[model samples]
Target chain A: MSHDLDWIAADWGSTRLRLWAMAADGTRLAERSSQPERAPRTPAEFETILRALAGDWLERTGTIVACGMLGAREGWVEVPYRPVPCAVTPAALTRAPVAAADTRPTLSLHVVSGLSQATPPDVMRGEETQIAGFLAKNDGWDGVICLPGTHTKWAHVSAGEVVSFQTFMTGELFALLSEQSVLRHGVAEAGWDADAFADALSDTISRPEKLAGKLFALRGGHLLDDLDPATARARLSGLLIGAELAAAKPYWLGQNMALIGSDTVAHPYAEGLAAQGVTVLRADADDMTLAGLRAAHAQLAGA
Target chain B: MSHDLDWIAADWGSTRLRLWAMAADGTRLAERSSQPERAPRTPAEFETILRALAGDWLERTGTIVACGMLGAREGWVEVPYRPVPCAVTPAALTRAPVAAADTRPTLSLHVVSGLSQATPPDVMRGEETQIAGFLAKNDGWDGVICLPGTHTKWAHVSAGEVVSFQTFMTGELFALLSEQSVLRHGVAEAGWDADAFADALSDTISRPEKLAGKLFALRGGHLLDDLDPATARARLSGLLIGAELAAAKPYWLGQNMALIGSDTVAHPYAEGLAAQGVTVLRADADDMTLAGLRAAHAQLAGA
Candidate 1:
């Protein structure tokens, strides 16, 4: 198909690189992804990887707005994190210095700096872009935004800026314990038991300290009582999410909260919250990423 | 040195086999260990492995008292778990059936049954033998005994029997997070910060739900503010143990607790509990294992 690409919106993470071709009006023209052998060790490598992934879509003097681990210190260029209590807008994005070698002369790359907090010391990379996208659509969201994933984040945004945030290794812990730990013996690869999930959620939220013991019980329950694998998997997830909710009570309690992530990941957060009588709105993670990148591109154009 | 071996006391776990030669009066004659290529798959395999490890020590007729995973369903013999609230004595031990093959008619083997609680549905193999050893040393002592290891256990003992207990995967979680998870980047393999550990213990105990976030903070703290790896490791250990202490409050609070394990592992638990104003007595785990096995031998003789 003949196309006139205006700019590129990219989310470059540690393991994968995703790029979206956009028109001048911020409409997506095309999308592509490539698994980099490893994280680019230098800016030159990043350019090579980026060009290889989106060489066809790059137009002369086109802008490329990227977010995620690409902005990390070990990424293409070390972009300093913007302290929290500040809005994540296109104006806040940092430009990466192109390599001296002539490669993609037409591509001007810009990476959105992640957000950081001094007290308690926490940080987020790509999620900031998702937050920016959610805020761009909502305009006046003054509550909590939960981004659940490998490292789930519970962020408190107010007056268009992230006031405070916390991250839980809940997702990673779940993956490791279920797939690698002794619990692996009892939990199935894929299954769902809503009742078990809910019960475990309630049980954990009410007494999160029981998490370690409860985790072992998933294995024991199966061995002793024939607790099905599906129920075991669901309960494991529920226990983790429940513990997270209990810890993040200060973030979601009595506050309007929205979940911004993939449907598969965010659904459990929604369910867990709803079980506690808390209603939450949901937003697609990819849509938000695109919107946030587009917003950054627009800021670059206006500049 | 030539030795007169009366009996053998062993703690055969999944990965390692530990054997202790005992005189008729319960004096340890010798000790040895070997890593089984894999977990013994059947009764015959267990017999083969056992004979290989201690064949030279066998007299004309000898009793082998064993504990730990040897009694597990997958171990030498599938011995039924003795429900808690009962004394762990030699009489409580189960004898594994001798295979008809006449390899070593001089050896009669017995494996101690582990303790199981139905309410929380927790099980322990080796720790029960240690508990039995501790109780044998201090009969009529009624309080809590904490055994720290791969799975830390807190048992409530009364009137020479285990009333109830809970198990925490604190050690395993620490190992997994520090060596396998993202936190591994921030934590050092060795070194410690006493102050950092104490602070984290207090923080997690007060707000355990914050565990997931606090754990992530270790990595963030290092990235943002150059948190030293030693302190990070100590803080991680403290956070896990603190969360455990919070959940095990019902067991440790207002109870005379003793820590039974190696000095290296039990010291932290001792320090943590001491920080909470609870002084705990320490018992060497190996010594306890030998004593418990000796007590079991005495019971076998009486029986």
Candidate 2:
């Protein structure tokens, strides 16, 4: 009997690691996740864990191609990054040789390279695949695409490759501001104030420099007098979004741009932008990441 | 030897209740503070707490003049608030009869009426007296005076009355933004970034509307890229201060203003405003509040 299994795909990042057992035709047979094996996990430990989780499948399968953190410098094995200006192809996800015990079954391992920014020196681990996935699915669309998360990505994608991008800590800031800041006391219930947000966006576009001081006004508006806490919180949202709009302006200008992410992340921008009469394209986050992972695995199976 | 203690000065507000035993000469002899007995405490309970703290002193001294929350409607004796266009004189304070109590202990408790803003529904607690003290000490100056605290106040003082003022929750915002927000991660350490703060302030002033979105950029700047947390924190500060400056533009009018408070609160604004060439007058907060309290008490004592 022939096993329909082929290459495996793993999306290992700093915090999450997901692996899929794919067939030669990109059919996912089984999937599993474990703590990312960065520096602490020994080869034996990884082998044991992988075997226990997908050992039966690995035994039946021949090669595994893992993208994301697994291919990082600090991954289980040192697979040199394909570096920027490289395509998200099988050639770029080239494998690094691993020394395993004689009892170990033969499996090919490949890692993907992360991207970095110059100047202030910013980088991302697993998001590149998501971007690639987004591009792969949308084929030949050029403009700015925002992937909002803890470390948000504002990418300029054209010609099927991410040309350049910037990361903003929007999600992290929201978490901190809502949960930790005194502004929490004044935040209103979750609801969008298109007018407030638009006002803030216009503020950013007009007075890019005012980004800093405007933050305190959130508290000032609510505290100096009786202010609706929900409005205050919304104002905070407006402020952060406004700042992102300002920082992302350089890349956002004169280009067709679409915001891709969850509703939680994209809706606010959509609301704010819609008020400004800017058309924004919405894309599903999970689908793009999964699709990208699937595409990477397909290329490896073909190789 | 008999002590001719002339007046009583009190600093009453939401959380704290402070009463000072001052001589006719305005020499403070002893001071007492407790949780403000606003509404929760009955007249008996309120008077008991007050008498227990200062009953003996009042007996030893002649008539005692008092100020602060003790004269509010919620006080042990309700003091009717003299509406706007009324002076902060001893007559205005004494015009309203104290609520009927047991034996009047020859102590005259005068309450200062809170100031209300017509344009925006807002009011000030005992800070008006503090503003009065600042004005009295400066010998009738016409300019802006900022009292920074839980609810920071920027008062336009001229002709002995607070002409018009706006309060900004600068202190509250600082507390909330620093502790509750994801910005907390980057702002764990407290250090001032003059440039970052100035930039934020400029950002706010330039784009007053961006007030809502500026804060999210903190996390974006810090997490997505390598931004100095210190600078990020300063940026937050700058955003708030900048917003305040924008709000205070009407009051400032490019005129020289005095900052009435300690360096702890005024220093940041002073530094931020210096760049804009706004001249600041620094005065002692304690001395000014005490002076105003004394003045109010003296008026009530004679009445």
Most accurate candidate by DockQ:
1
Local accuracy of candidate 1 as per-residue lDDT tens digits, B195-230: 999999999888887787789999799889999999
Write the residue-wise lDDT of candidate 1 on A14-51 in tens digits.
68899998888888888999997667888779888888
- Candidate 2 structure quality by residue, lDDT tens digits, A1-303: 233777677766656666787776667677788774443355555545555656677677647766665554445665543334445432346666654647567666766556654433345566777777777777777788877777677777666665666666666666666765545656765765666766776775566545444555564455446666666666677767776776666666666878778888788877766655678888887666666776766666566
Error of 2 at A113 (Å): 5.5
TM-score of 2: 0.68
**Where does candidate 2 chain A have its weakest 10-residue lDDT segment?**
A82-91
Chain B structural similarity (TM-score) per candidate = 0.94, 0.80
Worst 10 residues of 2 chain B by lDDT: B82-91
Candidate 2 lDDT score at position A100: 62
User: RMSD for each model, in Å, please?
Assistant: 2.7, 7.3
DockQ (Cα-based) per candidate? 0.68, 0.13
Clashing pairs in 1: none
Docking outcome class, model 1: medium
